[model samples]
Target: MERERESVSAMFGAVPEAAGMARDVLREALEKWEVRKGADDAALVLTELVTNAIRHGTTISVRVVRERDDALRLEVADGSRDLPRPRTASTEDEDGRGMLIVTALALDWGVRPFLGGKTVFALLKVG
Candidate 1:
């Protein structure tokens, strides 16, 4: 397999503003990589990951890597060691739908554990 990759990584404090910054960074990175087809979905999924991190951790770092010609992998690492689980949201519920959206958009996703925290990742196939 031929490998062509570009990556963007940044650290953000746990705050509401981090989500928007992440989206902007992802948008610019995708544009630079010429992978605009799934930019909206990518931004949405990135927002959810960052938001979740801000809620549970003190500091977060997000990395988006263009894995190949058509695959992009997004990883959000946080100070918390907890892994996220997808849950079925109630009809009247306003939350718990983030991971569902991720599952629907990503080709595959998973979590990786490190010494002091964990990284949640989603892979999107965008040509």
Candidate 2:
């Protein structure tokens, strides 16, 4: 069981449990930042980002901060320069569905090279 850290905004290894850890970090930030809207979707957005990074990269960095009065920026960086592609997944397919989740929750999202790799980010609305 992982406890929530008030300041878990740092790099984490590419491990399976890191996804859950990232959620804890987002939850902590939501409370600390006093975000009142779209808080639930923000958590889901962070989870999908971190999970995708852990699947394809080595070291992972997760950060959550208020990007503006109406949005929060959640970022997950990983040691992989390969960018994500858009693909369609059938209902029974277990793969290629992460992006769908991200799209559903994030107000805006994209990727870029950072920290010797790539960082995937999402902006979730707060109001």
Candidate 3:
């Protein structure tokens, strides 16, 4: 049987609750699609993306696209023109490892500049 494809987009304010709300939306989408085996990772990615947006940008938005070829793409956009760089972590630091994890796990990932901001995206293979 062929897999299904789905897409969703949301906008959020620069607040702490945004991340949790994004996670909830993603979880609900995954459940509705009957997607499994990467929901946790996806949720974590959502949190990282949303948190970064809230910290660095004036507004945040999330877009999730599930492809018929069993690929899922997660994108987070914010009103910041800066591009994301994956940094090497030190044991003493409590943060700065989210993108690294996403890079390690995602099939493909990149950043693109938009009208007033940039969108960071990660693609995963979901069956």
Candidate 2 Cα deviation (angstroms), residue 6: 13
Task: Report the candidate with higher TM-score, 1 versus 3.
Answer: 1
Best by TM-score: 1
Candidate 1 at 68: error in angstroms? 0.8
- Candidate 2 lDDT by residue in tens digits, 6-124: 33477788888898888877777778767668988887777778878888759888988676667678888888888876679988988887788888777778998865788888877
TM-score of model number 3: 0.92
Candidate 3 worst ten-residue window by lDDT? 1-10
Off by over 4 Å in 2: 1-8
Cα shift from native, residue 63, model 2 (Å): 1.0
Native-to-model Cα distance after best TM-score fit, residue 106 in candidate 3, in Å: 0.8
Could you tell me which 10 consecutive residues in candidate 1 have the lowest summed lDDT?
Answer: 1-10
lDDT of each: 0.89, 0.78, 0.85
Colliding pairs, model 1: none
User: In model 3, which regions exceed 4 Å deviation?
Assistant: none
Give the per-residue lDDT of model 3 (tens digit) for 22-46: 9988988888888887888888877
Error of 3 at 90 (Å): 1.4
Clashing pairs in 2: none
